[model samples]
Structure formats: structure tokens, C-alpha cells
Target: MSLVSYTKALNRALGDALAADEAVCVFGEDVGAGLAGMTLGLQSRFGAQRVVDTPLSEQAFTSVGIGAALAGRRPVIELQIPSLLYLVFEQLANQAHKFSLMTGGQARVSLTVVVPGSGSRAGWAGQHSDQPYSLFAHVGIKTVVPATPSDAYGLLTSAIADDDPVVLFAPAAALGVREDVTAPLGPVPLGSARIRRPGRDVTVVAVGHLVHDALWAAQELAGEVDVEVLDPRTLYPFDFPALARSLRRTGRLVVLDDANRSCGFAAEVLASAVEAVPLLAPPRRVTRPDGTVLPFALDLDRALQPGRDQLLDAIRSVMA
Candidate 1:
């Protein structure tokens, strides 16, 4: 029974994966120095051979990981910033991601890319602060964003062990989040949605760090309007069954998402809900403005992000 932070849980997962399998290796910028903090002490324990630091080339290193995966090696790539995914989009989407189907299942890309400090961070500016998980999910890549430390450890372990390319987005806003733990945390299967807060009025589906905000908002709304918080941990292969069950219990739906409002993950979830589950009222989504690009100003950044008030209003709207 002990408390664990989200970052620590991620570090523990990487450590466990490296220790359990000889074929597992880590590659990324400044990984040897443990710059991202998720690989802290891993280089010393696993040595330079496995925890090797890569050059400042996201595309090259990602391609190398793809090649290694094809040759029967499991590689974990640590991208320090969420925006760096854009640099290797072709390598991931066209090459590694396509190998399995393009070759008719003879090859595999067993690589796990961990984006530490993802999503909007205070004053990280427009370039550094981007929550691009929706892009990967839209392109048919497996995407995971766990809200709790226990879930972080469990899902990361599962991602590293899976025989396909997976992207793990650890939101910067939730990095400091801690949880009191007692049981031995184990692998949480992908595509599973967790009901963080149960209610009868409206079902609220939240993503990444926004899940915490949804839970807090639900508590604040209390007797005025009961709100259920559903964390769709895996966005690509979303937990439709869980969403359907929640929708059945509560006739209203509200999605609280951190991404931009246009064609975003929130929109997709609401669209799916209305089509798959019968709702007494119209489903609503609270998200950033359309074509939103994070601003350099701190206050402007905060204004552009989704918060408790937005979730509360969306919940109330759905209920009304």
C-alpha cells in the first residue's frame, strides 16, 4: 500500500519491461541521461547497450526502431515533446504502421512510442504544447492516454508487450497526479473505458488529464446534476461497449476533450454515441476552439484549454 506518481509509474513500467525481456531496448534523445525522467536510472541498470541515446533525428531513430522490430526486437521510443511526432509521421504512418497489412501480416512493428509531457503545458508556447493523440487515432494507430498512475503502469506494460505499433501519450497536466495504491498494478487491456465517477443524469467522456477535471467537475456539480465521468483510455480502439452501457444508464452524454473542437476526438465520440446508443437528449462536446493553436501567453493558453466550468455547462446542457 503506497502512493505513486504518474511519472514514477511510467518509469517503473519501462524498468520492468527491460528487466523481464532481453529483446526489449529503449532509444531516444538524452535517454541515457534520463532527461524525460521516465528513464531515470534505467541506463545505469540496463547499461548503454539497451538504453542507448539516439541522435536528434526522430525520423531516423523511428525508422531504426521499425527495422529492429521487423528483425524481432521490441523497442520503446521516448519522444520528449508531443510535437515531435510530426517529424516522423511518414516513418510511423507510411512505413512501420503499414508493414503488417501491406505485407499481408508477415511482418510486425512491435514498437511503443512514449510521449512524456504531452498536451498543453503552461507557457510551452504553440509549438511545444500540442495534444495530437487524435491524429494517431484518426490514422488507425493504437493510441492510449491513461489518467491514473496505476493505469499508466498497466497500460504502458501492455503497450510494450503488444505486437503492433502503439503510441502512449502521457499528458503533461496529469504528470504530477498521484494516487494511493495498495494492490499490485497489472496490465490493463487496451480499448477499455473506466468509469471514474458514476451518476444518473449525464455521461461525460473525458480524455487524458481532462478526466481528472471531469471527476472534479462531477463532484462540484453534486446534487444539482449528477455527472458520470468516463475515461476512454484507448482512443483508437475506443471502448464502445462501456460507452453504450453508460449511455443506457444515463440518457444524456457530454464529451470533455482537450483537443480542438473541429473534427476532434470529442466530436468522434459524440457521433459514435448518438449512432450506437439511444439518447434521450442531444449529446454535447466541450473542447477548444476550432483550428485552435495554443498561444504563447500563459493566460491565453489557459483560456484556450477545457476546464471544469466547461464540463459543468456541457453536462447541464445535456441534462436540460
Candidate 2:
């Protein structure tokens, strides 16, 4: 039990998994050298064979992971940048994702791709600031966006242990979050939601780092409104039942997501809530603009992304 940073939690989780399972392996750019903070010192600890560094070809290396998975090895790929996900979409979506279903459950793609810094990272701008967790969720692949140091550790551990390919988006905005570890945190079940702030006025469903932002907004509006903040740790296989319970209690919903609005994950949550649960008013969502490519300018970047004020406005609108 100790204070742990979000990134450090990830490092510890990977380290623990590598230690526990002889079949678990890590392959990525600069992973051996620990260029990505999450893989820091892991290569030397696990050895070169298990934590192998690959070439610059995302497609090739991703296919290699699928091959390893087919051969009964658990592979974890670290894509230094979020946008690199687009490069291996074919390998991940078409091949590894379909193996088990195509073969009638004869194969298992026990693979996990960890994106250390997802979403807008200050000056990273367009190419580097992609938050594509929705893309994976849309394709039926397991996707997780952990917001807390503990969740980051627990979810990643679960993803690595799952018998499927999982993409983990470690939000850049959430990497700095530190939590007091009073006890040993265990693996959090996938498709579960965490009630960060319980309230009676409204249910604010926040994804990834926005969970923290939602908490902040809830505190700011403490006396005026009781805003409940819910974090859906795994975007796909969403825990709608827990959300329904919260919505039933609050009678209102607001989704705060980092992706673009059109066909975004938040839109799906809002639509599903109205269909499956009772709501007093139309659900609201605070998200990036449709067809948006974030600008590099500091002000522009902040303007394009969802923030606490947006969550506050959305919560107020839903209550109205």
C-alpha cells in the first residue's frame, strides 16, 4: 500500500503479469529502452526474449503478435502514440479479432495493446492526439479506458489475462493522477462502472480522464446540485445495468467523452440509456466536435476537447 502514479501503476501491473506468467511477452518501439514510461525497466527485468523490441512496421509487428497469440503466448504491444492504432487496424480488427469467432471458439487472441498517452497531450496536436477507443468498441473488440491509478492497474491486468485482443487507452490527461494505496488493489472486472460521486439530481457518465473532470465539476456545483459521476472503465461490453440503476435514481443523464460527437461512444451511451432506462429529459453529451482534428495551439487544443465547464453545462441542461 503506497501512493502510485497512473503510469507507475501500469508499469507495476505489466511487471507483475510478466512475473506471474511465463507465456506473457511485450513487444513495442523503445519498450526495451523504456522510452515509454510504462515500460520503464521492464525489459531488463523480464529479459530480451519476453520483452522484445520490434521494427517500425506496425502492421508487421502487430501480425507478429497475432502469430504469437496463435502459438499460445500472451503478447502485449505498446504503441507509443495513439494514432499508430490506425496503422494496425487491419491486423487487429480483421485478423486477430476474427480468429476466435471465425474458428468457432477454437482460437484465442490473448493480446493487449497499451497506448500510454491517449488523447490530447498538450502540443501533440492532430496526428498524435487521437482518441480512437470508440473505433475498437464499434468493432466489438474489448476496449478499456481506465481513469485512476488503481483502475489503470486493475484493468490492464484483466485485459492481459483475458482470452481476446484488448486495446487499452491510458489517457494522457489521466497519466498524472495519483491515488493513495491503502490496500492491495485487485483486478477490476471488465464491463463494470465505478460510482465516483453519488448524487440524486443527475447521473454524469464520464469516460477515461473525464471521470476526474466530472468529479471536479460535481464538487464545484456541490451546494446547488448533487451530480453523480460514473466511470465506465470498459467502453465496450458497457455495464449498462449499473448505469440504469444510477439513472433510475437520478432521472437524468449526461455523457462526457473525449471523442468526436458523431457516432461517438458517448452518443451510444446516451442513446442506450434513453432506450433502457427512464429519463426526465433528453440526455446531453460533452464531446469533441464532429470531424475534428485537434489543433496544436494551446487555446485551440483546450477549446476542442471536453472540459469541466462543458460537463457542468451539460449536467445543468439535462436537469433543466
Candidate 3:
């Protein structure tokens, strides 16, 4: 078995895709230099044409990706910062995402929008530190958040191969996670939920990087309660059936997400679990305060984000 960091795993996936398929290409700012490390060495191996570096126009390049995808080419657009999604929302959500349906299945946009560093990065503050997966999910765009190195590789492969537009968020908090792999890396199907830890008392639904916090919280509370950790790798077209099954076994739920409390991913999970499944008690969700804007100060920034302590408390409250 070999150990690999999450960032390297992403780079490996991009390299593998470029080599495996002639139709696959990548475009972004500084892609030639691979400033994010995820696209490192890609330009050298794939050549400048396939590994393109666009001008500082996100809106223009984002639409260019959509156009390329519509022309039967699989284009992966890399956004160094997550907030850039907001700038090109119309291009992605309206243009790329709606092409297939709008044209009555005449077109399939195989475009993948990759955000390397999503969520808070200590002092990144308000603009650069937005976890906007929920926004994409709400608009019915395929959204994925892979927690481990293996999943990062597998999910990106699947995203590139998908017929519809897909958004892959590599949370900044999870970039450091490393894993040991004995098997050859492969695609992990979209809309699948993996059970990180099995238990019978309460099931904790964690999104993006919060999966680690959920697992740690589960272990910390192991003696007092049996906690199950469920990582819904794909947030949109969510694996609700799997979550429903877990809720059936645990009879309780607690969601840990990085997005804001109001209309966030956690709220959707909590609402769906309650409405579609039987719950022994009210569900709990640990997330940023409603309509939160992360502050510039270190302590104030940390205060705006969810943590293990908050997740543990929520689980305890739900279980009580």
C-alpha cells in the first residue's frame, strides 16, 4: 500500500484523466505553472493546448468550458478560490447545467468545475472562504465533496466522465488528509454515501471536510453512545435512500456542515431526514450562524465556523 496526500491524489486524477481520454482538457489561470498543486505537472505532460491557462476572466473562461463541453469535449475548469463560483454562476448553473434539458436532451455538457480550496482557511475572511456547495445543490447541479485522498481521486474521475455539469469542492480543511491505498485508484460513482463508521445509537451526517470532525466526535463519544458517521459524498441528488436506511438503524440524526445555518446543506439534510424518515427525537445541525460572514480576525474567524465541540454537543443533545 502507498500513502498519498489529498492534493496529490487530485493531481493524480487530473493526470490520469488527461492521459486516458483525448477529449479531456483543463483551463484555468496559472494552470501552466500549476499554482494550486492539483494541476502541477499537467501542462508539462499534457502540453499547453490541453492544459490551458486562461486570462483573468473567470466569467469568460467558465462559459468557454461550457461551450467546449457542448462540442463533445470534456473540459475541466479549475477555480483557485471557491467564491469564483459566484462570479460564473450564470455560466455554470444557467448555461452548462441547463443545456441538456433546455435542448431536450440534444446536448450533454461534460464539464467539471473544480474548486481546490473551499471553505475557511483560518484568516481567508469573508470573500475567499465560502462553502457554496449548497447553492449549487439547490439549483440541481451535481455537487460533490470527497473527504479522503482515495475519494478525491475517484470522485474527480467520475466528475470528468459525467454527462452533466459537475462541481467538485476540495475543502481547504480536508486538503491535508492522507490515506493508504492498496488497490488501484478508480471512479467512485456519484450519488453514493459511504458509512465511515457503523453504530446504532445516533447517525451523524457530515458534509465536505466535516466528515473528519464527525468521525472524531463519534470516537470521543463511543463509550457513552454508539455513533454512526455517514458521508454523503455527493450533496446534490443526495443519497437519501442510504441516509434513510441509517436513520432507520440509529433513530437519531446530527448534521455537521461548513455552510451557514440558513438554507444550508445541513438544513436540507435535517429537513429531509425528518420529513421522509422516522426520528426518535428532533434532528440537530451544527453549522455557521445564519447568514454568516467570516471575520478577518483569527479568533473571530474560528468563532464563525463549526467545530468538533459544537458537533459533539449537538449529538449529545439529540441523543439525550
Candidate 3 global CA lDDT score: 0.93
- Any residue pairs clashing in model 3, and if so which? none
> What is the per-residue lDDT of model 1 for residues 176-292, given as tens digits with 9 covering 90 to 100?
999999999889999888899888988989999999888888888897988888999999899999999999999899998899888899999989988888899998888989888
Which segments of candidate 2 are over 4 A away from where they belong? Answer: none
Per-residue error for 131 in candidate 1, Å, reads: 0.6
The digit string of per-residue lDDT tens for model 3 on 286-312 reads 999998988889899898899888988
**Could you give me the TM-score of model 3 versus the true structure?**
0.99
TM-score of 1: 0.98
Model 3 steric clash total: 0
Could you give the candidate ranking by lDDT, starting with the highest? 3, 2, 1
Give the winner by lDDT.
3
TM-score on alpha carbons, each prediction: 0.98, 0.99, 0.99
Local lDDT at 196 for model 1:
92
Q: lDDT of all the models against the reference?
A: 0.91, 0.92, 0.93
- Tell me the number of clashing residue pairs for each predicted model: 0, 0, 0
